[model samples]
Target: MKKKLKFNRDWCKGCGICVEFCPKNVLELDDELKIYAPRSGDCIFCKMCELRCPDIAIQIIETQEESDEEK
Candidate 1:
């Protein structure tokens, strides 16, 4: 299974909390104070960014492709 995190630049405040907390170094802040998912596949669905963001700009979603047998 793989997970993804998406950043809403407009809502981000350029805070580095997410970048600092991510164990995989998956996120980086741009000059405009917005966050970007530099390493999307490295995310472990920790949800730390989603929970800690003050502006509610980060979202994490699971993207496990269901096998044909499961379907």
Candidate 2:
């Protein structure tokens, strides 16, 4: 499964709760103190960041990658 992390930068307060809750350390703070995921590929879609975000800033977008076998 292919997944992506979406962040509402406007809602983030830089509390880092989501970062702390991330088991994979996929979330990080940028120079602006906003949340970002430099290691998104390591994410396991655990939704910890989404659930722990106090400001409701994080979301997990799950997508099924189409393989040639699907044709």
Candidate 3:
């Protein structure tokens, strides 16, 4: 199944933490430094970006019980 990714732009600090940590290269930064999911189809739902985000800006919507607990 395709995993859902949510970015809270207001909460993001444009730190690039999530962009750097994503193993799947699923995230990217724009010219303005805002983070976005560019390779979302490659996402393994590893939750690395969500966990590494200092601003708690990235969220992986639940596709399983484990992900549900995270929210």
Candidate 4:
């Protein structure tokens, strides 16, 4: 049940809002001001970044295989 967060550098404005809002400190701003996912494992699946991103550049995807029994 690992979730991954992807960042679109082209849309990022380097506002650092995502970095500031991330409770797990999973995101950081590089010299270019683009937000990068430094520690993705630390992400708590809290859509804080995704919801707060003004540029709408952040996307969180949950990757889990559904059990056939459940299906």
Identify the superior model by lDDT, candidate 2 or candidate 3: 2
The estimated TM-scores of all candidates read 0.76, 0.81, 0.79, 0.81
Q: Which residue pairs does candidate 1 place in steric collision?
A: none
Q: After superposition, which runs of candidate 4 have C-alpha atoms over 4 Å from their true positions?
A: 64-71
Regions of model 1 farther than 4 Å from truth: 62-71
* C-alpha lDDT (0 to 100) for residue 25 of candidate 4: 90
- Better candidate number, 2 or 3, judged by TM-score: 2
Q: Report the CA-based lDDT of candidate 2 relative to the real structure.
A: 0.79
Better of 2 and 4 by lDDT: 4
Compared with the true structure, model 2 gives a TM-score of 0.81
Question: How much is the lDDT of residue 16 in candidate 2?
Answer: 91
Could you give the candidate ranking by lDDT, starting with the highest?
A: 4, 2, 3, 1
Q: In angstroms, how far off is 38's CA in candidate 3?
A: 1.1
Model 2 segments beyond 4 Å from truth?
Answer: 64-71
Model 1, 1-71: lDDT tens digits are 54567677788898799889988888888777688876766777789989999899898755675421110
Model 3 Cα shift for residue 40 (angstroms):
0.6
Clash pairs (backbone) in predicted model 2:
none
What is the C-alpha lDDT profile of model 3 across 31-63, one tens digit per residue? Answer: 778778767778888998899899998888756
For each candidate, what is the lDDT? 0.75, 0.79, 0.77, 0.80
